[model samples]
Target: MPRSPLALAALATVAVPGLDAYDVRRPAQPGTDYDVAVVIDAHRRRWVVRAPAGAAAGAALEAEVEVLDALAEHTASGALPFAVPQPVGFAHLPEGGRAAVHAEIPGTPLRVDALQPGPGLAADLGRALAALHELPTSLVENAGLPVYEATEYRQRRQAEVDEAARTGKVPPALLRRWEELLEDVAMWRFRPTVVHGDLTAERVLVADGRVSGILGWGDTVVADPADDLSWLLVAASPEAADSVMEAYQLRRTELTDPHLQRRALLAGELALARWLLYGVRSGNTEVVEDAVAMLEDLDEHTRSLDAESSATYA
Candidate 1:
């Protein structure tokens, strides 16, 4: 088997010329077990290195490799359009097991600056995501990866909440929100599409006014395309998000599912809950702090949704 993504991220950080002096940091948010190092090169080239840690260490590494392989297969077969991580030399760590070097794509993460909905950026990104979703469903089915319907996703979170309760990892406020959100997600239904599993602004790389790279394929899975679209919607302003959805609809007409918006909201909550879990387990302060904010936002949204659903029927 090839080297894991966690190993690749570590090696990539160390191998980059003149980046050795910068302090390596942990994940800046909650429910994330990845160790992130922000390095500035001698010429002031900034890059980030993220490796999985704790029990997540080995599984994350392996998952990243699988994601790359899946991307390669899809890209070669003309089913996918994004550039995936290419692994170089790797190391074997006792804790994380394997670390490999990844070719650094040139671009800044999308979340760093204020995002404007340009004429084509949103459409381009949305369509690109759609292409990934358009892959052969049977192939993914054969792989036995978890397919996250909204209910399934919520159930997983409930399971996590139960785990947290047993372990004393979650606070009462967050746990209540988790329960409320799970109830809301149970009523949702959308057709399945391949999801990025970990869709966020940080994972998207943009350059020269366009999206140049989409990074972090470790969380790839088959699920609702709305899960992937949620990032674009959440990160962009409403107008920008609308433009993006319009562009996406033009390229991949299948994105017109009625349940799109609902699933998007659910996905965001799920992401927040996940980060919270990561923070608790890894003891990352930033992750824990962010999880609090995420819990609040998710709580409000879930309540709004529940009210809206009740109003619609009445």
Candidate 2:
């Protein structure tokens, strides 16, 4: 069961000594493993309180706290342009779990569809992502976060594709397309970089039309940078994506992979497969049905494109 906002507020008071009173309210719908709320103290200072849904999530929360601490202490001087959550306090729950408080980052979540095609905000977001990717891998490594080589990451993705295939639900054409991409050795060649492993649009925050903050660091890892770029390819408009890529390329110090955009697109496509697998594994029939509907839609779209190409050639 999830903890109430009021309950989390009480926990915040205990965790962060010096809060005589505060108002707590749910900020957004809870994620799979957390119940999140915003707490406004008597002095009008704001903070985010996150309580774990289970023991495994509690462990992840602790790990996130550690990562935030490391970033605050080690990387503050050369910090990226945007803000990351600062770990301020922690508390032990009555149910023997744990909760944490982070200084509130001031911004609303990015809504890609609502954005128009221009260099301003899009470029800022790209540059911010570049900064994050360019961060020294040592920070994550020393903090004991998951690190992987390009080949290793590809192997993991292949394994997931294989597992999804075994479920006997993924469409044959989609499976074949995914397998071909996975087996293309040249396509998988790239240096691993620090990545915000679960970088959906919602995790990116905007203020005054620029990226002001990034949230949800629990999946931080040293892995394929394409994972970080995948969301933008799907969510951002073509002109906006072009601007973003231009800024990202200009900002990056290291050699950018030529096939990075291709792989990012592939990653975006595979996300649906992962969603399907997750729904099946969790025994959520509704989710599974939804994923199936998406798969069918993808199949129709792919077929239409193929027909158009063949007609053009003829």
Candidate 3:
């Protein structure tokens, strides 16, 4: 069961010495693996407190803290464009984990569906992505984060698809399509960068028409930049996605990687395979069925598009 707001507030007091909460409440969305709460201290300053639910979550929390510390150290000379969570204090949880407090970063998470095709929210997201990808690879390396070259990244993705295929739950058409996409070696050529590996609308915060903060850095890694853009495919409209990509391309310091968008599309498709594998491993039949259905839908959609293209050319 998720912890109560009162209990979490008490824990927050313990985490931050001499801090007295004036009020406390549940966050907008409670986390699955962490008991989280928003607390307002005596001076009316907002803070977020989170406690891990298990060993794995605890380890992830520790890793995130280390990475945040490394990032702060590396960016001491003012490199980052937005705020990242930094643990202000910590306390051991009684149930065999730990809780940490962080001052609440400004702004709510971006509403991606509302993004439009202009120099608006989508452009801000594009700029945010460019800023993150522009960060030095040494920052992630110094934090002991995972790093992967293009070939290695492709191989890992191929391995994941192989694992998903073994489950026999994924649609055969979708599997074949993914296999072909993965085998296209020419599309895999792009420079790796330090990416916020688990980027989604929820992790992106916007305030005053710009990205103000990024939350949850546990999945930070040096890998394919296209993987970061894949989330936009699912969340934003096509026109908005196009605007975001155009802005991203304009801001990038490197020469154009012509295949980046195609790779991003492939990455978005592969996410379904990953979900199916997770469901099969965890014995979640409902989720497995859902993933299979989605994959089938994507297969049908792709086939229709291909047929239309062939007809148009003829």
lDDT of 2 by residue, 42-127 (tens): 89999888889888888888777777777775346755888889877889887776888888888889988876666888889889
lDDT of candidate model 2 versus the reference: 0.86
Candidates' C-alpha lDDT: 0.63, 0.86, 0.87
What's the TM-score of each model vs. the native?
A: 0.66, 0.95, 0.95
Best by lDDT: 3
Tens digits of per-residue lDDT, candidate 1, 36-116, equal 444444455445554556556567667676667666777667566556666544555566465554545677667623755
Between candidates 1 and 2, which one is better according to TM-score?
2
TM-score of 1: 0.66
Residues 1-314, candidate 3: write the lDDT tens digits.
77888888998899899889999989898778888999999999999999887888898888789889877754455566678888999988877778989999898888888888899878878877887898889878877779899999999999999999898777787788889988999988889998989988888888988888898898889999998999896678999999999889888899999999888888898999888888888999999999999888988898899899999999
Q: Which stretches of candidate 3 lie over 4 Å from their true place?
A: 73-78
Root-mean-square deviation per candidate? 6.8, 1.6, 1.5
Looking at model 3, which ten-residue stretch has the lowest summed lDDT? 72-81
